[model samples]
Target: MSEFGNLVDSIEIPLRWGDQDAYGHANNTVYFRFFEEARITWLDSVPMKTAPKGTGPIIIKTSATFLKELNYPATVQVRTYAGKAGNTSLESWYEIFDSKTGVKYAEGYAKIVWFDHETRKSTRLPDELRALAAE
Candidate 1:
């Protein structure tokens, strides 16, 4: 798998037949879902009550690079790494690999900002969540 930094979490996602496109490879958009799953899994590790009532992490930007085509009847392991953290935003990186063969399929990163649902503005990340991201 491509290394971005120290891995913080990982999850196995099974490929569904519906994930494939007319071209017979996994749809490009599916990679983003895999990354989302990994990111959510990592974030869920933090205490739910850490954030203020109306504040939570929201994706501000995301990007991915496909290295290989993913086919059906396979399983992928998505690994997440913690990146730089700021007062109101944090970075998360992802590496997707074939679970059995260990071949990397894609790599990506996302910038997530802490947001206040009520105010619709950026907010500071909770101390607990920030500590987890720093790890």
Candidate 2:
């Protein structure tokens, strides 16, 4: 919970050689992928009950701010924070830092809505998920 508090969940992602851009730093788009990994990992950690039918979390919007450049041969620690939760939507924040030096590389947030695949509409979040978000 450094700066972006309550996003205590974290995962480590190793930078690959191909992640680097022509300029030698990690591609900007790769940070979004890191955030995605953190978000999915965090959500997966929360135990939830079965949904009504074909229901799952879907990201409606996402954005990231580049703070520092990242290169290959490094590991990043991605941290996730679950923000406010509404009836069917919630916001998640993320931070990517050099695992060894603790230097921040990027930060981002995502708005997620619970959706029913079958009905093709937004649905209320499961109780378990809501509880997890509250934490």
- Per-model TM-score, in order, reads 0.91, 0.92
C-alpha-based local distance difference test score of model 2 = 0.86
Tens-digit per-residue lDDT, 21-135, candidate 2: 9999999999999998888888788877776577998999999999999988999999888777889988788989999999999889898899999999999977766665643
lDDT of each: 0.87, 0.86
Error of 2 at 51 (Å): 1.9
lDDT of 1 by residue, 1-135 (tens): 234655789999999999999999999999999999899988888666754457888998999999999999899999998777798988889999999999999999999898999899998877765665643
Model 2: per-residue Cα lDDT at residue 33: 93
Clashing pairs in 1: none
- The best candidate by TM-score is 2
Candidate 2 at residue 55, lDDT?
93
Residue 114, model 1: lDDT of 89
Worst 10 residues of 2 by lDDT: 1-10
Where does candidate 1 stray beyond 4 Å? Answer: 1-3
